[model samples]
Target chain A: MKRRAFMLSVGGAAAGMVLLPRMAFAEAGKIDWYTSSDQNILDFWTNVVKPKFEAANPGVTLNLVDAGDAAGQTAIGERALAAMQTKTDPQADYFESADWRLPAGAADAGLYVNIKEAGLSNYSRINPLAFDGDYSVPYRGSQVLLAYDTTKLDPANAPKTFADLVTWIKANPGQFIYNRPDKGGSGGNFVRRAILEANGKDLGKFKIDNYTQEAGDAALNPAWEILKDLSGSLFDNGAYTSGNTQSIQLLGQSAITMIPAWSDQAIQAINTGVLPETTGLVQLQDLALPGGFSRSVILSNGVNKDAALKLADFILTEEVQSAVLSELGGFPGVAWDYVSQDLREKYADVIPTTIPTFPGGDWEKAINDGWYRNVAPNVDRAA
Target chain B: MSLTPASDIVGKKPGRGLTGLLLVAIPVLLVCWMVIWPIISAIGRTLWLPNDGGTGRSFSVETYKFFFSDQYSLNNLYVTLWTTGVCAVLLVLICLPIALYLRFAKGRLAAYVQGLAIFPMFVPSIILSYAIIRVLGPNGTVDLLLNSVGLPHIRSPYLTPWGPVIGLVWDNIPLTVLILISGLGAVSNQSIEAARDVGAGRFAVLWHIILPRISNSILVAVSFTVLGIFSSFTLPYVLGPAAPEMMGPFMQRTFRDLNDPTNAITQAVIAFAFCIVFGLFYVRSVAKNRAR
Candidate 1:
């Protein structure tokens, strides 16, 4: 009888060892955050946010999975969609996606949780337009700015409008460059902005979905003409750089004096000594450049729904927004007035007043296809 | 010993048949699971549009039509074919001599050259691309060297098809050289000596005897190089011109950047079809060589 009692005691102890941890974990849920943010932003989150969030909510652990950079994010999104289709739990509770991909890529596919229904407090602080059917919150904003080497070109003489830019390119041939539209969104944005410039006040019509072939041809004709005309004046007589980073590299090497670049990327490049400090950025006054916000999307079927909501709230707080600006060189997710006065003044030129979101996927594909077919062939004709 | 009956021998045939089935079953199952299933799924994807919420499930040739009808799409095939042709020729011309030396010559220099030839195999394709860019880009190492000697700065062709061709050749040389060296090892040196004794010069021996023996290896090298160049993404994406891009990068761009999986699958199917043609040639060459 004593030996039987001892065996029961050992069995009870083994069960207790396993049960205790489970009971402890039951109190504090874990959040898995997958992001495509760069290394610096990831570092900021891990070093700064993770510890504080965990400290405040005891026993809670924040797991940050690096989904990859821009292209990698799309791949993750595709995987997440596949998981959702199979009724399996997605690998991530929250994911960060590029702004341009929203409404067509992730948001349209119903991959994100509705923030309003989730009762996130900071939802109101975000620009309502940034809300993609209340499924995502804008985490950071970037504008396509015309960056130039001040050493090569006088800043005062910089182009103020599309027309002025064309005239300047003609006079200083081979001094300006833009990447291929299909390769990088920055170049794509430049083409879209040029289309806007070409169409004048017909931007709304072009923004519409399901354009007939005749309608698309007529609307995009002037833009093609402008691109073909400007091709002769581009760097290397219309041989465009293949990617956005290449354009910045050429500017740094003084191979070209002017190129279209992302505001945050250009500034970050300067800070990292990739571009010399003499490099300056300017937004065209007459033409509103394409600007959009990268967003934090909470998956609907995420494991830790409450913890994910808490984490989203923590990310949108003023402290994190300030860090995003100071550390990442990104425009704040909140309004400019909400950030420090110094930051507002420092980035006044780049702080986008007229941010234009990308049209849906179909329109984007049409635009890319049209540029390749119509404009690309005529690029070197004049040269 | 007593003689075995015919019925007894027939009874043992079932046991041998069972053993044979056991041996081949695992391999057959593995091939079906790993290769055939995926190929079937890929082919299915080409036929059907994905039911991405809006689009209802239906069989369609729209994807294939879209890909073939577009000139931009067709240019990708042209670029891939051109690059593959150039790289195949270049790899053969460059690797054959080094391979011959490694097989025929016996010295420290041959060993050193062999080491140098295979050294690039260790370097990743992406790193090799960047290295080529650094060496051949505008105002790069080559330009710098030329400038030091007071020569005019020549524009870099590194941003064109030539650049990718150079990188592809450099990357593929090791495999080609290894194959050729193995083929040369099988070429009997005694036969070459006998031919020489009969008034066959070095050129005649190489052309008449060595070439015929190693033709299989040459075919293997050429086929592999063509396949590698056709499907190569990193070298062409990093080095080649934006327009007239290779099929690999073009498919990726169409799929991810354009977010059109159907069109991308169609392109993949076309690429697979090309690979199958080359693969058949490889199989036939090996079969013929083995028969001989």
Candidate 2:
């Protein structure tokens, strides 16, 4: 009798030990988030978003990881790809992606969980154009604009067209700077606009389904010629800044009068006193600047799929959208009617009636390659 | 000989063999897991093409072929080699004299110079790169100083290869100095003094006695500098020109910016090949020293 009792107690204890963790796991789940976003974004998500999320969904913790060191976005994409290839769950349940990285990263790799299929309610609020085919929910928008110091250059006299900008660059030598095309998207946008002006072709022709070498060569030749001609008039003759931030810093310090900048970044810099308050941004009337939307992605292979979808949906909420605009100086990802009138009016000038998207992946690669081969050498020689 | 029991010798062999196996097993396993496995994986990745969007994967040497054939890629390799060679030579020239002075000279001057030499190691490379840009960029501190002095502001080479070379040398000098100083410690002061007393000139003592003694350290420092500079990304990325970029940043650009992992892996493999060639010298030095 004693032996049977002891055996029974031991069996019960073992069963309890096994079952307790299962219950706890079901009760308290975890959501891991990976992002390459800057410090402000990280802080806002941690301090503001995390607590609210945790409060809304009881017994869930959010873990934010900085996956953007020396490796940058490639490392994050590679890890996601490896996880999919191995048929295993990815390390992070959700990923924060920039506009430029989303298409090549999560969309290309097919790593994102389809929020629409998952029945996320707030997913419908996002603009259909911002959707990368059910892979992402657009969170914020940024527009590439030409920034100038009001003290140095008159806003009324700012160039209204690409041709006028080129003429202005030549007339006011050593006052304008743009980053290397391959280095920053703002500079690349400027180059793409120049191509549009030079080619004088329908913009729709550039957006091809597949990349053809011959088409790319024919399209970029005129652009190379224009850049080569303008090389002599660039800051310090042809010494272009390496990145967007450097160009902004030069403008802030009154070293250069004008440069291409992201609208949100310029506003943030002005707010932070990194740039003078007199710094102003403008979009040329003839040349439509490239603008894109950043998205929140849920990994297809995430361990906590339900929670991940919830988090992604939560990011698209009006409260979070307003916070994105107020805190990050970013435009709302939702339509204008969804946001307040004040927020719309504040960013009215920078916001366009229609956002110009990138011409497709092939054109992007072609521009970078052509610049390296044809335009860069001339720029270097001119310098 | 006396009839020593064969069983007695055989009896101790098992314990001794077990101990030897444990000692060998630990480091062998470590090296296999840490070094060999990752290298094999990276090489495997290069062979298997990444699934680029809708494109399916297949084993091919096309990536390697592109790397070898492309002029831009070739220029990247050349730039890396050029930077490594110049940094190695310049580091040796600068650090050798400082090491000699610190080893032989007495007083606060030597101490002060030694302190200054190692000071850069404390400042982070990212911070140092920014500082270099601030001090040397157009209309920067150098230009400001020139203007203050009522002189014309001169253009700085901060946007060219020379800029990165200067930053790399400044960043690497501390490590080279420390190694060379340690090497100098092996050369006894008495031998140098005795050679001097024997009517050998300063250059002769250096060439004959000190050079031979510290040759291994110099080799180590040069190999390390070459390896570090070849794989370096920060200084080159921040300070070097956009075109004719170093292999590190070029590979990064190819991988991240261009979204071409296959080509990036190929570049990495080429860099790894260079490292292996230089690493052999370090292994040889260690083995030769052990033999001696």
Candidate 3:
């Protein structure tokens, strides 16, 4: 009798172990948030956002998984797409910094939730320009700005236009630098700004969906010529920094006087003492530099869809959006009217009126590859 | 008469052969599953590229044609080969002397020398790259020293082809020393003493006696160093120049940044083809040693 009772208890316990997460989800559901964001942003989410969000809604847990790199994030997207097709649990609640139109047919198949219509109370506060397609939520934005050391060059004499910037580069050789286009956004947009100038500031010529091989080649030729002309005036005679941080480091090391740097990164560097306090940031006046937004999309097939939607809505509230600026060194997804007056007043000199968007699909690939071939050819050297 | 028969002692027993097979089976299966299958799959993907209309997939060599015909890709391949060759030669040159000292010298200082030689193994490659930049880049420690003495600044290797070469050589020294020291172990001291008694100089003893015995080990070290340096990514990415990158970074940029996986896989397959040559040298040396 004792043996039979023991067998029955074992069976009951095994069933409970299998079904508990599903049955008790309303009481305690863990939202698996997948992201490829930088370490500081992850820290902001973990240390600042997670605690507050979890406390307000006691049962829901925000689990941040640092998906290592771009490839890891892409794999998560593919897995979500696969689960949607098979009508199974995606095991993922949210994906950060994802290209929403990926996995080829994901958009058509409705793999991602329509985030704008997911019952977000703060939906009206989002900047209309940042609200792209409404399939993903744009939480923050970053633009490339001209970062210069004040001691080396006075702020009043800084270049106000792309034309002025070019002349300045020519006048002060080895005093300016930017990273490689393929490596970081600051350099990529510096190249893009040049392209824009080459095309007579015609933004309409470049579109999100419009890039053919022949068209891309013809459009980029003038930009290459412009870059090649300025190559001899650059730091170390056309040597580019490897990435965003390297450009900032060069300024810190007093190796260069000015560089094209991401606004968020430059600000963070100054705040963290990586770059000196004298480093100043300014945007171009004639034409605004292109910027990118970090967007998060919800998986339709997620097991914790309702709770994930709640968290997604919570992310857009003024509280979290304000912290994104003060703590994380990022631009708010909401317009300046919704942000705190102090932040607006403080960053008035550097904040852009409008963040121009650049097509990341095919245009970026063509430009990066062309830069290596036409602009910066290898120079022979002995180690 | 009391002992077991000669056949029982000399021949393999049925259970013993089964145990040997069992012992080797797990690792062999793991290698086939983990390493071999992925390589085959990657090679297969490189061949079946997307069609021109972007509608269907078919077998094609267009990616290979692009890689071979493109000057940029060819230059990257050339840089990778040159970097590997230089790092291998430097590693052998630097590590052989240290190995000989550790092998022949006696005292606590020799132990300390061995410790210092193996120190790089513990430092991560990323940290080593940053340290290299701090010590050797513009306005760095070396430049500051030069300035203090009223000398010219260094032509920094931070963003040149030599940048990755320096980092890789430093990163590879520890393993190279260990291999060389182990190889030097087979050289008995009595032979060296005999050569000394016959009036042979240090160079002659090394060339005629020590080098011949350690030639296989040197080959092993060079082969390992060549393979490691050829596919190295972090050092090359962080330190090397933007244009004409090594094959590792080239493949990565083509795959991730350029969004051209087919071309990236083709680049990888080409690198694999080059690495196989050195791999064969390692295999041959191992086979020769086992025979001896």
Candidate 4:
């Protein structure tokens, strides 16, 4: 009798587990998305973006993998490349990066069906800078800025140019920070801007820019001299090379007064209570930072390219745009004029007019050579 | 130097039994395939990169010129060699006394101390670097406490190259001590008593008896430690800013950073060749000692 009772109880428990939840979710189709967005934002993409898409396309399931943090933007692209090379099936259906890695073989993936052919009328909504061949599309963007603690300095006395930022760093020893370009932070862009500023070139003329012998020597010589003169005042004699996390921590502790911070880092610091409310971000007036792009590319190794386009179209929707901006802190890379006033106002602070880009085809090579591995300890050592 | 007890049973056949052979082959091949292969491929791609994407990517000097002509790369190499050489020697010297003490000391207390000595090995290098910084940085625990105690604050350890060297040596000590203890164990108590009876003082006994008996193990441990420190990447990357860049970072730049696998491979092969030449001598020394 006791054995029968236990068996009956076991059967009852199994039945309850099945019947207690939304059993309709099992009928969904799976669309795999591989992305490098942050955890919380990705959770929003999975929970908010997936369900909304699945609700529209009932049989499709969405499986979103956090591939970005697992390795990096490069490694994720390499994994896809390997999959493509080996002709592996069921490779990630969609791929994305803050910067479109593997930009060389993007079109060779033989995956993405054109947004026009895929019936994506919303392509008109995206910016021309982002709209291209079916291989990839810009995800979203945030303007890189020089973030600082206003409490440490009056706004009236705030830095207006890269030169000013450098001066401020020198005046306050051991309190400035930023990551290197090779280290995956936008340090390269800042370094380039410094070179551009030293050359006295107009910001608009900065494109596919080559670091000439003159540029490498003349522009960087002053920068290096200044850095060398100011080196003793840097954080631990200019030894503390750190990413946003460490820099932010130091900023919170009043250890660093300045950094070349991206919008997301500043936003995250504010939200997480790392940055005080008095903290401020300012775009450099003289030198534009043409760095930082979030490219959400269409990748279909085996899944439905047509279906993937449907998802892409859905993601670029005004409603989805609003959701992504509010939830993920993503600024639009489209003809963002049509966005709601609320969206415009929220992202207004972060967006720069012309974010510096790799001006030349060999942009990475230029920066790696130009920036001294994106970390010219002395501005003079740029070559 | 493992003995073949049943070699007489097989006249001309010179080999281990199946179990012994499998044990050796499995581990040896596994290492060669996994670790050695990737390392070789990385170096190969760097050194022998084709002028054009086709058949044989023959040898070239462009990669080397690109690597060494730049002051950055040269300085990085300088940093790596200086730090590794200094730290390895320091690691051996510091651990020798600790190893001797652990071997000679009595009771469970010594075991506990020895355990504590090795505990840092379990901590990740990243975490260990942060802890060192927190204690030794300008605003770290030491400075904060010193200030509170009414003493003038001292400079941050981060400002000096010693910050990284000390950290590296600290990380190496436990393994060094372990090697030394195992080596010292091979010195039978009989040998010590024999030396003492001969009117040999403590220093004489250690120099003649202990040193000679355990020299093989010491050599083995030193070989591994020096190479390990040479290959170490992350600790120094974080710890020292002013220090010259090391070989690991240099290789990373040449291949990974430059996307030039050919030159990177050549440099790696050079490093591997350096290791092998020394490794042979080290192994030969051990074999010679064990045979005695």
Top model number, DockQ? 3
lDDT for each residue of candidate 4 in B1-292, tens digit (9 for 90 to 100): 2245455354543333433454455456667988888877766666666767687778767776776686776676667678778987887788888888898899999989899889878988888887876787656788889989899868665535566787888888888888889989888889889989989999998899899888787788778777877777666666666335567655666566567666666667656765776588678987897797
Docking quality tier of model 2: incorrect
Candidate 1: tens digits of C-alpha lDDT, residues A229-253: 8887877667667777777877876
Q: Write candidate 1's Cα lDDT for B199-222 as tens digits.
A: 999899999999999999999888
Looking at model 1 chain B, which ten-residue stretch has the lowest summed lDDT? Answer: B1-10
lDDT of each: 0.77, 0.78, 0.84, 0.65
What is the docking quality class of candidate 3? acceptable
Which runs of model 2 end up more than 4 angstroms from their true locations? Answer: A1-29, A37-40, A51-59, A69-87, A98-111, A117-124, A127-129, A380-383, B1-69, B106-112, B199-204
Error of 2 at A150 (Å): 2.6
Query: What lDDT tens digits, residue by residue, belong to model 2 across residues B23-99?
Result: 45555766898888988887998888757685877787878888889887888899899999999999999999999
Pairs with backbone N, CA or C atoms under 3 Å apart (clashes), candidate 1: none
Q: What share of the true interface contacts does candidate 4 keep?
A: 0.16
Against the true structure, whose lDDT is highest? 3
Model 2 pairs whose backbones collide: none
- lDDT score at residue A194, model 4, on the 0-100 scale: 62
lDDT of 3 by residue, A1-383 (tens): 23333355556555545643462221239998988866667877899889999998998898899986666787877888887778766778888677787766787788889986777887788877787787888888888889999998899999989999999999998789889987778898999999999998888899978999988988899999999888878888778888887888788999899999888788888989999999988889888788878888888878888888888788888899888787767788887788989987776655678677778778878998899888878433341
Of 1 and 4, the candidate ahead on DockQ is 1
State interface RMSD in Å for all models.
Answer: 17.1, 15.7, 13.6, 17.5
**Candidate 3's error at B68, in angstroms?**
1.8
Residue B55 lDDT in candidate 1: 69
DockQ of each: 0.14, 0.19, 0.28, 0.10
Give me the chain B TM-score of candidate 3. 0.93
